[model samples]
Target chain A: MTSTTVTSDVPALVFVDDLAEGFGAPARPFHGASPFHRADPASTPIDVLDLGITRGDGVFETAGVNHGHPQAIDAHLARMARSAALLDLPAPRIEVWRRAVQEAIEAWGSDGHGAAKLIYTRGIEGTGVPTGWVYVWAEEPEGPIERRDGITVVLLDRGYRSDVAKTSPWLLQGAKTLSYALNQATLREAQRRGADDAVYTSTDGFLLEGPHASLILRFGDEFITPGTDQGILKGTTQGDAFDWLEGQGYGVGARQVRVEEFAAADAAWLVSSVRCAVPITRVDDREMAIDRQVTDGLNAFLLERDC
Target chain B: MTSTTVTSDVPALVFVDDLAEGFGAPARPFHGASPFHRADPASTPIDVLDLGITRGDGVFETAGVNHGHPQAIDAHLARMARSAALLDLPAPRIEVWRRAVQEAIEAWGSDGHGAAKLIYTRGIEGTGVPTGWVYVWAEEPEGPIERRDGITVVLLDRGYRSDVAKTSPWLLQGAKTLSYALNQATLREAQRRGADDAVYTSTDGFLLEGPHASLILRFGDEFITPGTDQGILKGTTQGDAFDWLEGQGYGVGARQVRVEEFAAADAAWLVSSVRCAVPITRVDDREMAIDRQVTDGLNAFLLERDC
Candidate 1:
């Protein structure tokens, strides 16, 4: 993937050596695909005190860009609204967000495939206002290599019991907040252990979620996913997929997943808007069956569906 | 405290309204109480995409400034360094931070009293560099009065067992990270429930730390804090207070605390660098004992000693 992370050079104050340049230097990132365009990315500044940056007090969603369009825009926005409410943030302006997404989609055209991220932060604290923006970038072509060749997975404890979400509202367990340090750390931890990804098991020992996606298990024809009541962000892509699958007369439902089930499942995969679907062929030393039919069906459905 | 959230006019581009203002704003947050003196708070700019703002991918520390001097500059810096390490961020330059503290303290010049917050974020997401800065502001004169009167607290579930720290490193349980949405939300949850603050209980039922402070229990002359293995951030102020209490020949130690024990203790307080010490006179529906002597001793030690 030509990650915006590496592809677009957003001008920054590199404090290590060029703090002065950060404050006063040249044209950096070539602002890509904008509804609210920063013709000069270098000058699009962020406040030093933005609590979003200072404290990660924010929420975000990513819409997949495939087949020359921003896929699942409505689903992403709806999820963002839910994430906002979970954080007690003001209800987002759906009209405004819709306009931005439309602009983003139009700006990108059908030139390439990537992702568009929508960010909404509680603004600088105390203002009772929020800061919101969109960033769209093309992923490197090799980003989806894993989807074609399944991934190896490991389970890591998410540190909360499976049922902690109902009673502990403050954990914001269902919100997709900007405070992603732990999520990123878990991926690194999995990488360190020679795995491609980590599936979090709640402290109570129930399998929970992947850091950035939802877990799906297939026991023959039944399509099962762990319930959202377990404190994980509801997966928009999974929801979209299940809706389409159920309409086709396939079994789709939510159930508590046990960690050991992955070791024995006939088929499994991680699903998200961006990655679409990454089949789990191996779960911690146990090789599982990968029904190419299930994986292929979901990926094709994910791409063909409209938000 | 006269929160800048409520006091200072920290300028912002209310994107929900003037998205244009966000793109064309002049010098964002009026840099308040400058150490590296921006001269015009209105001109100090933060990049729009700083990961700190984008991801809350950072850590922070607040030094209590009293009688015109920033307290525990060294101790706070040391803790920041550790917080940085926990997040896998680079080790902060202690001397650079020390100079900032010195400059901040020197500039404030015995004015009123409040807190000086030191922030270090992993810069913008794709950029390997990081952003670091300090903000100093005065507290409302009445803010500290709560310390004298004690606070009403409600116990909230922190959603982890006391020992989850050792088993779940990615949780960043002990790190004083900027991902404070949950922390802030817990305090709001407490306030909405008719309480002044919240004390977190580990999922397994052990008493942990407060959202922004450490849990301190007094059993007669015993000065006790919950063990750090419970995944609570080690409080810098609590450490300073414990050192003083021990030097004065009082028994100070770490122990596992239970919820019911609060009702039985001679005194209980939440200690932190900024809040100093807040005695908890009541918890939930249970009224707890608050020993004036113990509360007074700790407060005096807090003000008299430097971190």
Candidate 2:
């Protein structure tokens, strides 16, 4: 009954007051005030009838915070905007969100690495107003500093064809919504099968992405990720890594990749905002080789990158 | 923002203390007290990091509360347990939940009608303790007394094959988890297409249920709903209606219904706990006949059902 033990790492929270006022929407009457204000995460600022939780009608982004810098936040914000559009909730005020994230990070005052999560919801039911918040908490990375080695993953069927996004946009396939129960279920399924993570595949035998990350496979010098057209998220971390990879003269592309190509790949990694580039050592029953040099490079670039 | 206008229907909430203690789980150390306690929904009892909102890692059921009676609550609880098992959450204490619902309804003090929504979440992230709450408020039945006419529906591709539940359990298809953003999106798409609601169809041409309701088709004296094997929630209202229909000498069944069969059916109704049985007047551009007699009978049974 008492929550003394569960009260560890309370996040610094900020509620965005002008979340849905973007995209030529009329400004609020009180225009001089700050767009967002910090709130207590433990105080539970959200309404019980908020569509975000009740109907899972919301989108979110989590960016890694290094020292005072929120890493790859612009891309995260852009993706959040895309997700919001996909859900048809409202246009997110990118400037407001950026300031909210900074405020939350500043409130947290963590010089170490942590995760800054931005949550934008469709707001309370029957009310058109949207709710938005950003919470930052310090994340003490367990074990080694770099997360770039030996992650075994199982390929699970996502139960949709690769072209589901194109055929059925209402399915919200490409949108990074808060409705991630199935994604969590996939990871649990992976754990049950004695694997560390899961890589989702289309029913038609095409590699998609991980439950919460983007999958990038290496075929000789060419690095290919399952295209965003395949109803998967456009990974922010993956994008940053691709930029670094391109600069290093490695071919990078996002296209329809077959599951059979996993076996042909020299190495693979599941990339995400918080976790960065985690090397895939095993896929299903097959043992995949780890490209340690490239993995190290990607992780280093991701950890040190300012933007 | 001072939330004054949006604070009209504050539901009476009861938090179940012994939520996940069912299925042979050991009782908590403090056992000599009430299993649940009333809380203010406006206070936001949920943790910001609760998986229910964060990952949509939860299951919920909303039963129609007619006066003091919670309609088909046992069925809803059973379904919630099934959903929790599917999501690997600990089993819910049904008796405790029943009492919590009763407490919430009693606290609401509404004699007319309302919705009693039971929410069982996986609790705050990394905390094993599950969170359970039931909220009840006066529904005040908007407009007419009966909700059994003039509903137009559009058939949208659910983007999964009919046998997805059998082939891919990790998809969490049949389980009524809290991840309903896509379902909300589907409804939006239906509205955009000038329809009131949507009925999902399998990629392989099988009839699935609606986003938030069960589709029941009537062909003369026979009533048929999609089988549970199609990865859809088994409708509690539909089941009660089936029992009532059987007693009325009508044939009722749950089977693998095809999309083509919808056209052949004489009448169709989308049934849910809160809405009862609403007759579908149209499917896409095609107009369908509404069986007023049968619809009225079903609604009467659903609205007046005890226990």
Candidate 3:
């Protein structure tokens, strides 16, 4: 497949066929009509549309690129596996996934200018198994931000359906499924209420993560995030960063973070594979300054790991 | 369209080419891509699908039939309109829906069936409006139940997505979108726990309603149901029963019902378009006797209506 760039005011629409062609590789096969089946089958080849992403039934993961290679590839794969299992979905073959990422990066050439996303989903049709429609996409890099200038966030009381199980319920929290209509709605609501990004809180007032991202706070020199048991996904980037932080003699831990505690953190940021770590300047209407120690420590950690 | 009835060992399957052909009169039509549309567009045309009852995305009204004719036809039409409005869908043309129902019943001959269903939904594909698929299917003699023995109900903590709105959120609640996968899952889970049906409670512990049905209770000769404020679709059957009961001098009211209140009720049953009132024998693990008041009141109500 050929790749072309369109210079329109609208966001680039990357065709799915081209994406699959660039990322597709031979993988282990399984047979079942359900989207949750672990094995690929000889039935109709699946595409992105077939995966409930259009309907928002699947989950996804992305990672920082180092020298045009995804960092902590195994961690992302393992997380995807866990998410798939939780949703009773068939897991994609790791080797196939690796090859797809490699090809996707190769398609982007040696620029090392963008992040890579690995999206896995229940293929088209409600058969309940993973279709072999996995692919990677390259996007413009997020600009570096002043760590001292934290980002602002909004707290929305719109409880997520998967808020009870942290990550066990495959319906929402586990995989980056396509059931994102509500997430988008929440974001729109947050925007309407004047906020940069929204942190979803359950009806009981427990702070979840930001939409399409994870939350991290720096207390003293320690890096802290809400535990996965607190109804949030076990973020791959957060996990890697925590391990690296602890190894460097910095305090890093996971614990339950109440909504009030998050609102009053010393320093906070939203973490994701694409944006790495973006500091939070304000939450709802409350504001905070970025922690220099935390930012420097995380940047040094990312650079040292070549992420 | 031809009408055919196939009696399987399990349940009877009735097929109709046109829903309008069955409902005696065509209901009013609305405009737009979904049945939830508020405006009527000149470009839109009414359409119907054969997979009406199977998928359950269509709006239906079950009213007592007198001499094979429905009562309070306007109320059902108005509810269907509200359902269509919520889904941003179009309603069927009133004349078309009326004619369809009339033709179907005449075809059925002298079947002294009391219950009639007016099903309106996005019909078969390729009709105008691309999304404006609408149809009606009528059924006589709703499902049979052994009311002498109460039915078992399983309590599910899984929250309903739209609980704050009085009308069904058509995109999510009303207008009968074809997303019944969760409903099926809930039923399977209930059956797995050895229950006849399931009652979905809100995340806040308020009793919502049953899957594909409404809640009714007999509390000291007063018929009580959850108010629309509790986030249930204004049930037509429940509304009719309430009006009829109040007119008959029985204290009937709609109010918010807590989960504990539902559990503690002396007698309860679920009312819907198809199932008039099925007694609840067990809730979760707690069992209750089938209160004679519910049966007596319901039978008297039905008999007084000349059903």
Candidate 4:
């Protein structure tokens, strides 16, 4: 439902209203020694000319934090690096990214759930350098609720074939780039349709992914997600969950799924780091049977995961 | 080949280095009568938390100003409004935009050529309001040179079909939103391949558009551009020029264009508001025949006419 404000203890994000009113969260925020930024993320100074904002010419990673400990930090960092390389961006400084993460987590405190985001942008107009920073925000209370209640979804075409990732480097198919207008628009479209979520299909009528989450299907005991060849982002949370599930003796894998097969699957999920996984019980507003036992087992296993 | 800098008289866009040195354009930019910002375009303080920067959840219009006269002000505003409506964003207040434009143009002065951009975002996260501003940048020195020399281009797959916009409203295919990461990436890929620009073709090999500009093809005396049905942005400059061309007794129209026809056409031009009309002398590393006379005629007609 929402991505902001997960727990009461997570530090405030300092809204413009908060700043104007001089209320909520301490005025001072934690700062890393990185020259890219000195002020806390809430007040981080980014030149308007920076390609990151102006052209949305940047990459980013969002990781979930529980009790101030970030989940899947390595996966997020690795993906961000891969995205940078794809964009021909300079390699990200791992040590600096680590410091920024540590500072943000400590500054926000360990009391509750939070969301930490790392942004890397090609720097100012003429300079080919980069600007990188970390920002932490409180995860909204709705995250847990969305996880429990499950969701209904509508199908939308992602406007691409399944194999473009192999041919077109310019599309940035799997990168977690900051140019998220379409994803946001898709989610809003779902809301407007009175559906809780959306699943994107490729031009060839194959299930691709959710706008913000990965799609996972269970056929009997086998768990499958669409392969990277489908031009979908690799899901860090889904990968982690699969590892834990395999240890518990579940068959796990990735492959392409046609829209017809998706409709026939025993169970379906739109999985992500923050939401963990939400069962999708409807496709295009048509209600369907759901294997609740599978949903419960996977959700339980994911909650037990510490990293 | 750049989209920035339309005029010589526009204010200097402050670079990070400029901010550090306290030099160049007067640091105090124009504060719109709106409370969103009080600083000028060069120094406007936007909260890092602003969704405009973080998510690229916004719409923008770029208009050229020659002799302090903003070209196509009405068209740009109307297009911005259309884009906002398509995104489910509130209709932009035209009066407010007009004032912001006046303030920016006056501050920059009427000298040579400049670029004015209006950006509108869905406010500071929670307020359900908006953050809008006008920014002016001096036209780059090479814009005219590129126009005169014409440009070479390569073709890339846009990963969409021609009808995605009509069938999937969620894709936001034709709207000119601020989420331009893919467009910028495509341009970089073009530059890497020794080309001045890129033309995007649909997955089915239909001619779509140039990354930021529109594509116009000439077959003898008939001039045609891919229609709106092709999920392409309706080019303001292209439309205006076509109107003038029709009056001048030239055949002008819109329809689906396959890559084959595009390659076989007598000549082609990548048309946009800022670049006007630039000849495409190559596609996919292969040299194309240049009807320099047609290129010259279109560019001259575009340059002589202004809003």
Better of 1 and 3 by DockQ: 1
For candidate 1, give the docking quality class from DockQ: acceptable
Q: What is the C-alpha lDDT profile of model 4 across B16-101, one tens digit per residue? A: 10111112123223322232222333332455655676788888888877767777788888888888888877777675576667
lDDT of 3 by residue, A45-112 (tens): 22212323223334456666656677777888778777656544555567656666665566556545
Q: What would the per-residue lDDT of candidate 2 be over residues A64-99, giving only the tens digit for each residue?
A: 998788999999999999999999977898998999
Q: How would the candidate models be sorted by TM-score, starting from the highest? A: 2, 4, 1, 3
Interface RMSD (Å) of model 3?
Answer: 16.0
Worst lDDT 10-window in candidate 1 chain A: A12-21
Score every model by TM-score: 0.84, 0.95, 0.59, 0.86
**Model 2 chain A: which ten-residue window has the lowest total lDDT?**
A1-10
**C-alpha lDDT values of all predictions:** 0.71, 0.85, 0.53, 0.71
Residue-level lDDT tens digits of model 1 in B223-301: 8899887888777888888887888788999988888788777878999876788899788987776677767777877
Docking outcome class, model 4: acceptable
Q: Give fnat, all candidates.
A: 0.56, 0.63, 0.01, 0.51
- lDDT at position B139, candidate 4: 73
Model 3 chain A lDDT-worst window of ten = A1-10
lDDT for model 1 comes to 0.71
- Kindly list the per-residue Cα lDDT of model 1 for residues A221-271, writing each as its tens digit: 788899999999788888987887787788999989888676666788899
- Name the Cα RMSD for model 1: 8.8
Q: Name the candidate that leads on TM-score.
A: 2
